[model samples]
Target: MWSGELLDLDAYLARIGYDGPVGEDGELRPDLGTLYAVHRAHTGAIAFENLDVLLGRPVELGVKALEDKLVHGRRGGYCYEQNSLLAAALERIGFEVSGRGARNRTRGDTLLAVTHAVLVVTVDGEPWLCDAGFGHQGPREPVPLARPGAEVVQGEWTYAVREEEEGILALSILREGIWRDLYAFSPQRYHPVDYVLLNHYSSTHPRSVFVARVIVQHPGDSVHHPVRRALVGRELNRLHADGRVERRSVEPDELLALLDREFGLRLSGRDAEELVRINRAGD
Candidate 1:
């Protein structure tokens, strides 16, 4: 049973600039077609961002709130907001979408404690993992859940599914030929409130990377810097766009300025100096 309102399929598609009607089979549409549609909606319309933290706004998990942000505000959100919103939309369109959570092992065992969100969909009797809310764009193809060899390639990221311990499944990705942890979760039941707790920690906890820095995604690339003003060494840093990766030092004020000029983000109530101090310590 759906927890909230049934999403308006036409309006949702319109929100993302799709003029076509929802197919009769609902979300069992052509896999490649659906993948393209999702990509277009996510990349062309929404602005992947993290301005809420800077503006002192709590990231809410309600469907209405997510619709307001994604459809009205024309913004991109973190995992909780993104995956929940996508799941709701898919459900309305007739896809068997479920809200699931995962552990982000890439950040280390300590950071792995928090639960992250993902969406699962079934198409043509096959389980497909779909995530348009991830900061980077999604795979050009749907990731088959039942097959060990299922894979999708997008630029430098190759995503695949593999069985993990205790019969639980894992989602692994190859970044530059090295397999790394993206997230891990199963079909265990989940609720919006469950995400609220993790969302709070991700946005406010002293140890959260988002609390210490700001991240903004542009059309074809993204930029990350400490939320405060201090300089922290980037674990893996590369700025690529227009066929080149520019390695440059971004100052506190300049970072703020770029937030407005490039990413269409205008922040308020954020203490830039404080952020810098926190960032310096992490560095």
Candidate 2:
């Protein structure tokens, strides 16, 4: 259902630097190990950003569109683009992948619309929560859906799936000794068309944060003690493994360099100029 056939699977595998998970038959395996390897590789190699929204461009969700922009273009994306690309790769490899719409929980107790997109991959009779979006504070690997409240540690970060009200499950992270909710989703499966509508709001609506400011995130650089980085508007926040946050103002002149040097996001000359104009306008 993710339109995997349209994706350049070889390019995606190489883009993420995932070398081998192929079985003895010289075919990609659809096992839990491959799932973990691909998930980690994708999250590490790619970044999470809303640059298109900030650039007044539409956020496309089709597999080929995703491949052209995210994989081939070497650009980072937010929820829909990130997860949909992931779903396609896994589905192409013969994994049973499904989509889900989730609500943002990090923005305090306020209830928000269901705009975020995630994927559920079923492997060997077990389902796992797989997301490459949600920015720096997000998980790098799949968290077990079968084991509620059990923490799955990825590098220096730890994550768990907690059962919320009704049939919904909330993904929580242990930060500063507290289980902070990242985002929550119900069992209601989502389709690409569903995300098209959500993307409309997130990309164009005046109330959407993505349309209002710049957002770029990556899990971290190191495997053992990764430092999660997030750039929101003019402020750059770096969250250390031990729960320390070091934030600084990003000047317009230094914005592009920060994105490339720290987040691995490099835009073309024209796009870079436009981004700088947008950055200056935001201030």
Candidate 3:
């Protein structure tokens, strides 16, 4: 639960580009329509990025820190930061929210550790999974927490929630004609301290992919838009809604401008130059 003063609703709503109706008491009333609107607005406004981790900066999880870095600073963050912020806002808006830990099985067969975070929101006695941290692979809207084989189609993506075991749910997406598992999570609730441990390991560990390369993502222009842009390492990729992908390597000199123009990130010229140099040297 969050207090009104701790989480500024006006600032948050503005940051996410949400202008939906609110109660006369100046509080958001939780409902399916508002939840969907807020979820869509957030995913479209804020990006899923790890540039701070690559820059060797500490990732903070506190609400104020998240507000400063993400909302006010006009920057994007990874799962922990993004989901934590969303959970706080949702809670402040009179929704029942809980944090859950998940394992990323998208890249390999072996079950990975609990390194991902998601939100379980209850409305009208039913649960829904809301994730705004997954860059290009996440759903555009919340999906009802249902049994295996239950599918939710959003634009070009079709997602399913599978019951891997008793209390564990696996979220999979249809990609290239294959149903690929994105991540798996249980019903147990997580806390900010749990995210602290996960964030430290993800930001500092040498083997962590976030620290190894530069990754940035922002949603497409509209729900009907077919393309989303992402910068992975030295390549910029445009992912089409119909499974068509266009990619090109980014030159070192053009990295800063691209980040600012395409990703809506503003960084000091010195910092930008250093990032480009480090990224190129790593390649």
Candidate 4:
């Protein structure tokens, strides 16, 4: 149960800039069109960031907490927060949404823990991968589960999910004429409590990448021209839809400005100062 009833649907819709036709009861239809619209609108509006981890704060997965920080507070969050809010909104709108934990394969070939959170939505009796949390290189719209291994093009990007060894499905992006694996997952469904454990390790573990880096990503938009800008630690990379990657290093003085100007993340004065200090330490 995603506790979708507890979510303020109006505020959530407004936050993502998705204005759907509402009925007399203010309900949007549960269909593929709504799913695609919400998925695109959410990713385009909210950024993906780990400022709380960098600020030495805990990441809460509760729907209310997510609404407070992400929806009301106008801040961005990493996977758990992103998809949890998405799940709540979709469930509230009457879509059958389930959680799936995926092993992030972008890092390397060695088998890593299933730390990434993705969603499987059932629409018209078919499963579709709806993920709003995989950062800049993630899909802009839902990928059909029924059409696995078939190329689905969204704007300038192309994605396909291939059947991997042992019932695993790997989502890949076509980059520079190569189908590079982004992540893979099994059929096991995860509960809200499951994410609590994963969130703990991600935000607290000393060796966890989020605990070690200041990561913020913007997967661009219509007005922004579909250019993905990802700032990991000190490196700022701009990935174009045409596969052009513009890289640069972020100076301590340039940190806050870059976060606001590039990723649309505006931290408070205190958070900004602390982030600058951390950047200066180069940790």
By TM-score rank, best first, the candidates go: 2, 4, 3, 1
Best by TM-score: 2
Kindly report which residue stretches of model 3 are placed more than 4 angstroms away from their true locations once superposed: 1-5, 24-26
- Which of 1 and 3 is ahead in TM-score? 3
For residue 35, what is the lDDT in candidate 3? 90
lDDT preference between candidates 2 and 3, better one: 2
Query: Candidate 3 residues 1-283, lDDT tens each?
Result: 4332487767878988996667788767898888988888888888888988877789988889889888888788999988888888888878898889999988878867889989889999999999988887787789889556788888777899988667789899887888889999998998778888999999999888899888998766455566788898899999876778899999877888898888888778666777887788867
Q: Model 1, range 99-204, lDDT digits (tens) per residue?
A: 6777776666655674677777777777777765555433333577888656656444467888777756677766545666667786686666777888888888
Model 3 per-residue lDDT at 254: 85
- Model 1 residue 152 CA deviation in Å: 1.9
Model 4 Cα RMSD, Å? 1.5
Clashes of each: 8, 0, 0, 0
lDDT of 2 at 150: 91
Comparing 1 with 2 on TM-score, the higher-scoring candidate is 2
Candidate 3 local distance difference test against the native: 0.84
lDDT value for model 2: 0.90
